[model samples]
Target: MANQLSGLDQIFSALADPTRRAIVMRLCAGEASVGELADPFEMALPSFMKHIHVLETSGLVQSEKSGRVRTCRLSPDALVGAEDWFQQQRATWEARLDRFEAYVMKLKKEKEGAAAKRPSRASKRKGAK
Candidate 1:
């Protein structure tokens, strides 16, 4: 359990940065060399490498050095934990909201039913008159 929490912490912490998130998004399409990945941003290669390092440490990405080129690809399995967590959260919230809606609707119907059972002052006056 501790290991799972630690892994989630690392994944969320690594993804907290915009640059790192963008890098992950780009990698989602397919693998690319470090140069290609860094091309879109105006930062220096070294600066960009810091983001890649974070991603690697988080297990979100895997890179291989071949010749002079370093290529990176998404580690889809790493995202499974995060995805599962999100799906569970979504399901819980959906169930809660559905119950809330039902409660609200029940209250509304009860209110309407009570209102219908009561006679208006005008009707009372007409009957008395």
Candidate 2:
């Protein structure tokens, strides 16, 4: 569990940067050389490489070196852990909210029941008069 969380943290950290995210997005279509990936950005090659390094380290992107060209691709299962975590969190929150809604409904019903059993102010005033 801890290791999974550690990996998830790394993945999230890698994806935190817009540059890295964009790289991942581009890789989703298909693999591309590092040069091709960096072409759209204004930053220096070294700076762009740093983002690629993070993605590789996080296991989100896989790269191969063929001579001087490095091609990067998105790993199909890279986000599985994060997606599972999100699903579990969503289920837990939905359950809690459902319970809260039930409790509120109970309280509302009790309040209405009490109101039904009570005499109205108008009736009391009429009797007094």
Candidate 3:
């Protein structure tokens, strides 16, 4: 569990930078060479390479060199752990809410039952007379 948290932290950290996030978003469309990926950014190649390095280190992107050209592709499964965590949290929250709803309904029923059992005090006094 600790390791999973650490992995998620790393993933979040990698995505924290705008440049790195942009790279990931672009890769979603399709694979592209390093040059192609770098073209849109005004920053220097070395700085852009650092963003690529973060994505790679975080397991978000995979890169390979074919001869002189390096290509990058998105690894969709890299976010699986994060997805699983969110799903589990949602499920837990939903279950708790369902239970609370049930309890509220039960309380309402009990209150109605109590109200039904209670007679008017004036009717009781007239009966006593």
TM-score on alpha carbons, each prediction:
0.92, 0.91, 0.71
Query: How many Å off is the CA of 73 in candidate 2?
Result: 0.5
**Candidate 1, 3-70: lDDT as tens digits:** 88789999999999998999999999999999999999999999999999999999999999999999
Misplaced by over 4 Å in model 1 are none
| Deviation in Å, model 1, residue 44 alpha carbon | 1.5
Could you tell which candidate, 1 or 2, scores higher by TM-score? Answer: 1
- State, as a TM-score between 0 and 1, how close model 3 is to the true structure: 0.71
Tens digit of per-residue lDDT, candidate 2, span 51-108:
9989999999999999999999999697999999999999999999999999999999
Q: All models: lDDT?
A: 0.95, 0.94, 0.93
Off by over 4 Å in 3: 99-129
| Alpha-carbon lDDT of model 3 | 0.93
lDDT measured at residue 98 in model 3 versus the true structure, 0 to 100: 100
Per-residue accuracy of model 3 over 1-129 as CA lDDT, tens digit each: 998898898799998998889899999999999999999999999998988998998899999999999999999898999899889999999999999999999999999999889997988899999
